[model samples]
Target: MSKYLFKSRLTPDGMKGLLSEGAKARREAVGRMVEDLGGRVEAMYWAFGDEDVYVTAELPGNTSAAAMGMVVSSVGGVRTTTVVLLSADEIDEAVRQEVHYRPPGG
Candidate 1:
């Protein structure tokens, strides 16, 4: 499984739904959506900023993540930006691999 961080902003319609449904209900709904995709929600938070919600989840893979994002956005109530999360060890492994590259003016 791969982890992902989803930053979401609710549209005017979404905000109305949230106000009607309540925060907990919305969170639970998000959790259920993730579970339906063979994933689990790790953490979720409501924030005040460019994004209204932040959700960390473990998903089956990139394709699943993309599908989830697409479905949510297509609803027209929310917009999402997904970031693939990697563990420290994953970064260590990444740095261990190398590629040849040239700077613009090297």
Candidate 2:
């Protein structure tokens, strides 16, 4: 499984739904939706900033993450950007890899 971080902004309709449904219900709905996609929500937060919500979830892979993003975005009530989260070990592994490369201006 892999971790993903999602930052989202809700449209007016979505905000109205959230206010009506309450945060807990919405969180549960989100959890169920992710579970359907073979993922689980680690944490979901409602914030006061440019982004309305932040979500941390663990999914099978990029496919599941892409599906999640697509489904949410298709609703027309929310916009989200998802970033894949890698562990320190993954970064270390990446650092050990070597590839032939050329500088952009070289």
Candidate 3:
């Protein structure tokens, strides 16, 4: 399993639905969605900004995360951006690996 951060902006219909349903219902709905995707929501936040919600979750893999994003976006109720989270150890290990690369136009 891998951790992911999902950020989203609710569409007009999505916002209306959320307002009508209330917070607890929204959370439950999110929980159900995560379960359906074979993932777990670790944390969720509703915010006041360009993005309406931020979610942290554990997903089976990139495909699962991408599929969830696609479904949510296709609903016309939300737009999502999913990012894979890497651990500190993962970054350290990456630093130890050797690769040949050059900056574009360098």
Task: Highest TM-score: give the candidate number.
Answer: 2
For residue 39, give model 1's deviation from the true position in Å.
Answer: 0.9
- Tens digit of per-residue lDDT, candidate 3, span 1-106: 8899999999999999898988789888888888888889999999999999999998899998999899889989889999899999989999999999999998
Q: lDDT for each of the candidates?
A: 0.97, 0.94, 0.91
**Collision count for each candidate, in order:** 0, 0, 0
lDDT of 1 by residue, 19-97 (tens): 9999999989999999999999999999999999999999999999999999999999999999999999999999999
What TM-score should be assigned to candidate 3?
0.91
CA lDDT of 11 in candidate 2?
A: 96
As a whole number from 0 to 100, the lDDT of residue 86 in candidate 1 is 99
- Cα lDDT tens digits for candidate 2, 1-106: 9999989999999999999999999899999988988889999999999999999999999999998899898998799999999999999999999978999998
| lDDT score for residue 13 of model 3 | 94
Each prediction's TM-score versus the true structure: 0.95, 0.96, 0.91
Which candidate model has the greater TM-score, 1 or 2? 2
Pairs of colliding residues, candidate 3: none
